[model samples]
Structures are given as structure tokens and as C-alpha cells.
Target: MSSAEKGLRATGLCREFAGRDGSVRKAVDGVDLVVRPGELVSVLGPNGAGKTTTVRMLTGLLLPTSGSITVGGYDMVRQRRRAALACGFSLGGDTGLYPRLTAQQNLSFFGMMYGLRGDRLERRAARLLEEVDLADRAKDAVGSFSRGMKQRLHLARALLHDPAVLILDEPSAGLDPQSAASMRALVARLTGEGRSILLTTHDMREAEELSDRIVLMMGGRIRTESTAADLRLAAADRLGHVVNVAFADGRVPAELEHCPGILGEERDGGTVTLRVTDGAASVEWILKTFPGRTTSVSVTPPTLEEVFLDLVAAS
Candidate 1:
């Protein structure tokens, strides 16, 4: 199948649960998600946003109350075996690992479940350990490994089947800065190899850095879906523009604090960031009003986290 036809897709996906009082609550309400081949889409949301429920449905773990899911052209609900075979998942945190087993042993076991056997399973297990930088620790029991090491093993297990689509739920969570960076690099490499990836993460930087598209989901529905740049721009339009200014004497002047066209201002060390209705006017006002206090000024889009909070709060 062509790349366009070989990816993960969900249409009108919804999952509802009955509360103790018989009140039905929708955990996921008509969420439509897609990750094209060679692309990575990140889903971001606050707590109880139905992200977990949606992912479970997509992975065939939990059945959707309504809607359809297709992974690599196979119906997830009807052709479950084929859909499962077509997609792999790395669900981070404490899940699906034999703490007493060695890394190689763990991979080998999961590989067999994927129908791999004999020398093929052994070879794939070895290669994957090396790929995740865990070859040296392959013989070590998983229980002894660090959180980051366990995360890498989860990734290796997910890839053992060599599926066409991958789903990662906070693959970098609990890892140190260096380990997180390494995990992100591996995720990026997987997309370049033409595998579609659907990632759900709370880390704003991770979503912004690795995702081709960022999906903002809240109240069990997708509020916005766009590229990082476009999302930032859209958020700016919905709210206001960001103007970062560094003072000339490395000090913010009190006189320029409540200037025109400036919606709000925040001081960060030597730089003063202003949220303005007009980007050009804000910069001009700062320069013309107090040219001596301004050393450098640039209009830039709000950060991804900023965009996320602004949109979520507004919604």
C-alpha cells in the first residue's frame, strides 16, 4: 500500500463509562486522530482528558463505545489480529515487563509472541538492545535497571514485531535530561524510517520538538490540531503577539512598563517580554519611547507550552 493509505486513523472515536450513579460519562468524545506514514503526531492534554482511554482504544486494549479505528488499512475492531500486527506500542511506566528477566530474555519473549523464533528472534533481540543503547546491560535483570533503561527496553519490545505503525505514551517520562534526549532521538529516527507514530505526552518540549503535528485535547475532545509553528501562530492570533526585549543597560526601565499596544508584560532577568495586540506597534513604542533602555527587540511566537495553556484555559 502507498504511504498515504498505510497509517493510523480513527474516526469519531468515543468511549463512555457508566458511573456508580448510572450517569454515563464520556471519556473520549468523537476524537479523530491520524498519523501519516513517516510522520509523528503528539497528543497533549491535562488530566482526565481521555488521552489514555483514546490510546487504549487505538491499541485494541479497550473497545471504543463508538467510531472506527484503522491501522495500516486494517480495521482495528474487525481485523484485530492484523491491526495488532500492523502496529506496535511503547506504553511507558510500569507495564508489560518481566522484572526478573534479563533484557534479552524480555525481548525474546515478546518477539516470540510476534511469531518470531529461533535465530531470527535472537538476532532481532540483540540488534534492538544495541539500538536502544542497552546491549551492555542485556544480561542484567530488568528489575535492576534504571527508569530510563526500562523505557528503552519497552521501546525495543515494541519494535520487535517491526510493525508499520507505532504508538508511544510518554516514552520519555521519568528519564533524566540526557536519557530523555536519547529517547527523543530514537523516536525521530523511527519516523524517518517511514513508520507512522502516534505519541501522547505531557511534556510540552517533547511534543513541540518531535511532533510533525500537535493535538490539544481536553474534556474528552480534540480542541486543536496543527503543526508547532502554526499552533503557536494560531494561539498568538487568539490571544496576542509576544515581543521579547533585552534592555540596553541590561535593566528594565519602569517607565516603559505600561506602554500602549502592550497587553501585558513580564520580566525575565535582563529581558522584558510583552504580550501585545500589535507586534510592530509594541516594538516601535519600546524603541521610540525609550530608545536608551532597549538594546535588542524581536517579535516571536509564544512557546508551545504557552500555546497549550492559553488554548486550554480559553476553552
Candidate 2:
């Protein structure tokens, strides 16, 4: 099948759990998500927003209460094995790796379960270790590896079968800054290779940097789904654009004190920030009005975190 045909799709997915007093708790409500080939979509949500539940259902670990999920065009419930073969998943944490086993050994075991063996398995394991920058530590026990190293090994394990789609759950969670940057670089490479990727992350900056589209979930439902630019644009309608101007003497120009489009303004040490209706016009006006007095000026749309906060607070 073509790569596009192998993209991930979930329609009206839902999962319910039995709670105390025979109450029914819907962990995942009617959620629909799609990740096309050569694209990356990030799912962002606070704790208990059903991201994990939805991911489990999509990956065939948990069957949906009522919905359909397809990976590489294979049904997740009916043709699970086939779907699994077409999908590679890396779930964060320290659960999958065997502490005493070497990295190479770990890959070999998983490969065998995937029906790989002999020279093919060995070569695949070696290549993956190299790809994840763990080739030199191939024979070292997994327990000896760092958290970031183990996380990369998890990614290597997921790619053993060369699946067409990838699902990553907080791939960089708990990673140090340098390690997280490395992991993000690796994920970016995967996206460049034209595989469909669905990433669930709490890092708004990471999502903003990596995703082609972002889906924000709240209370087991999607609050919004769109490109990062579009999300910011949508927020601008409600909160307006944010502009920060740095002045040499920390003074607010009298010209801008009563500017028509300036809805709000605040002052800090050598800096003045404003909330204006039109970003471009406000920026242009600021530059023209301040001239030499303004040292630096920047106009930006609302950040992902700001948008997320607004959604949560409004709800």
C-alpha cells in the first residue's frame, strides 16, 4: 500500500470504565484524529484529558467502547496484527526495557517476536543502535544506560520492523534539555522520512516546533484542532496580538499612550508591552512613532500555552 494509505485514523473513538457505585466513566469521549503521510500531529492536553486512553485505543492496546481506528488502512480491532505491523509506537517511561539485558539483546528479543531472526535481525538491530547513537553501547546492560539513552533505545525498538506509521507518547518526557533536543531532532528526521506520526506531549514549545497540526483535548473532548499558526490566529480574535517594545530609557511614548488600536499596555524595566487588535499595523505604528527611542520591537501572536490556559480557564 502507498504511504498515504498507511496514515493513522480514528473516528468517534471512546472508552468507558466502570467506576464506584456502578457509575460509568468515559475516559475517552467522541474524539476523531487523523495523521496523514509525511505529516506530524501533536495531541496536547492536561492530565486526565483522555490522551492516554485515546492513544491506547489507537494503538490496539485497549479496544474502544464504540469507534473505529485504522493504522495503515488495517482495522485496529479486527485486523490488529496487520495494523500493528504497519505501526511503530514508543511509549515513554522505563517499562519496556529489560534492566539486565544489553541494548542489542533487547532489540533482538523484540525482533524475534515480530518474526525476525538471523542476519536480518542482527543487521536491523545494529542499524537501529547506530541510528539512536547507541551502537557503541550495544553490549552494555540497559540498566547502565541513562534515561535519555533508554528512551532512544525504545525508539529503536519501535522501528525494528520499519513500520509506516509512528505513535509517540511524551517521547521526551523527563529528559534533560540536551537530551530532549536530541530526541526532537530524531523525531524531526522521522517526519522528514514521510512516515505519519502522532505525538502526545505536554510540551507546548515542542508541539509548536514539531507539529503540522495540533489537537487540544479537554474533559475527554477536543477543544480545538488546527495548525499552530491557525490556533494563534483564532486566539487573537479574543485576546488580540501581543507586542513588546524595548526603549533606551524605559519611557512610554506619549504618542502611544492614547493610541486608537492599543487596547492595553504595561510597563517594565526599559520595556513596554501592549495588546493590540492588529499585529502588523500596531508593529508598524510603534516603529514609526518611537523611531530612534525604541531599541527593539517584536509583535507576536498568542503562544500555545496562553491559548491552552485560556481554554482551561474559560471552561
Candidate 3:
């Protein structure tokens, strides 16, 4: 099959769990997602937003309550065992790696499970260890590895089988800055090799930097989905460009609140906070209307955190 045909696709996948009092909680509610060949998609959500649940369903670890999913053109539920071999997944925690096994041994074991043996397995394991910068530590017991080292090993394990699709949940959850950067670069390389990846992360910077598209989930539902630029643009229009105005006379700009598109305003001492809806127009008006009274102005660009907070708060 073509790479695109071998990509991951899901439609209305839902997972409901039984709760106390016999009530059903829809942890993953009718979620639809797709990952194209050579693309990196990020699923962004707060804790308990079903991000992990979604990954589990996609990776065939958990069966969905409803809806259909296909990975490498195989039914996720019906052909689960076969589908599992066609995809690689790395989840949070240690992923149950053999503590006594050396790094190369660990990779060799997983590669063997995927039907690789002998020189081929050893070569792949050696290459992966080198790719992840752990070749020197190939013979070190996993127990002696740092958190970041373990994280890299987990990734190496995922790719040992050369699966067509990858599913990762919080891949860099507890890594240092350097490790996280390396992890991201590795992900980029995987996509460069035409592998489709679905990743869940709580890191806004990671999501913004790696994702071709971001899906934001809340309360077991998709809140919104957009590219990073589009999200930033929406946030700017909704909350407007923040301008910090310094008043020379120590009095609130008399006509500040009267400006059109001024959504909200606050004054603290001689500083004024104006939430402008039309950032450019409102800023121009401020300059013309309060030229002499305003001493300085600074604009604060909306961050991913701010956009997410406003979205959640409003919902």
C-alpha cells in the first residue's frame, strides 16, 4: 500500500468506562483523528482529557466502545494482533523495560519479537543506539540509566521494528531541556523518513514546534483544532493585543474606555491595561487620542497558554 494508504485514520472513536453507581463516563467521546504520511500531529489536552485513552485505542491496547479505527489499513479491533505489529507505541512511565538488560540487549529483544534476528537485529539495534546517542551505553543496565536515557531507549524500542505508524503519549514528559530537544529532533527525523506520528503532549512549545496541526481536547470532547499560526491569530482577535500604557499625569487615560473594540480595561497606579479586539486599529486610536498623555506602550503577544486558558475558561 502507498504510505498515505498505510497511515492512521479514525472516525468517531469513543471509549466509555463504568463508574460508581453504575454510571458510564465517556472518557473519549466520539473523537475523530487522522495522521497522514510523513506528518506529525499533536493531541493537546489537560490531564484527564482522554489523551492517553485515545492513544491506547489507536494502538490497540484498549478497544473503543464505538467507532472505527484503522492503522496500516488493518482494523484496529478485529485485526489487533496484526495491527499491533504494524505500528509502534511509546507511552509514559518506563514501559516495562527489562531492568537487567543492556541498552543493546533491550533493543535486540524487541527487534527479535518483531521477527528480526541475528546480524539484522544486531545491526538495527546498533544503529538505533547510535541514532539516539546511546551507543556508548549499549551495554549498561537500564537500571543505571537516567530518566532521559530511559526515555531515549523507549523511543529506540518503538522504532526497532520499523513500524509504519507511531503513537507516543507524553514522550518527553520528564526530560531535561537537552533531552527534550533531542527527542523532538528524533521525531522530526522519523517524519522525514515518511512515518506518520500521533503524539500527545502537555508542552505548548513542543506542540507548536512539532505539530502540523494541533487538536485541543477538553471534557472528553474536542474543543478546537488549528495550526499554531491560526491559534495565535484567533487569540489575538479574541483577547486583542495587550498594550501597557503609562500615563504621564498619573491619571487614567480619560478617553481610553471609549475606544471602539476595547473589550476590557484595567488601571493599576499610572499603568493601564487595555484589551483591544482590533489590535491594529485600537492601537492606532490610542496613539492618536492619547499621544501627549501616554508616556510609553508595550504589546504582549498572546501565548499558547493564554489561548488555552481563555478557551477552557470560556467553555
Whole-model Cα lDDT of every candidate shown, in order: 0.90, 0.90, 0.86
Which residue runs of candidate 2 sit more than 4 Å off their true CA positions?
1-4, 248-250, 261-266, 284-288
Pairs with steric clashes in candidate 1: none
Error of 3 at 201 (Å): 0.6
CA deviation > 4 Å runs, candidate 3? 1-4, 243-275, 286-301
Per residue, candidate 1 scores C-alpha lDDT tens digits across 218-265 of: 999999999999998877766778898898677788887667777888
TM-scores of all models? 0.94, 0.94, 0.86
Pairs that clash in candidate 3 = none
Report the lDDT tens digits of candidate 2 across residue range 182-203: 9999999999998999999999
Pairwise TM-score winner, candidates 2 and 3: 2
148-238 per-residue lDDT for model 3 (tens digits): 8888899989988899899988889899999899899988889888888999998999988998888999888888988877887788977
Q: What RMSD, rounded to one decimal, does every model reach?
A: 1.8, 1.9, 3.5
Residue 155 of model 3, lDDT score = 90
**Candidate 3 overall lDDT versus native:** 0.86
- TM-score of model 1 relative to the true fold? 0.94
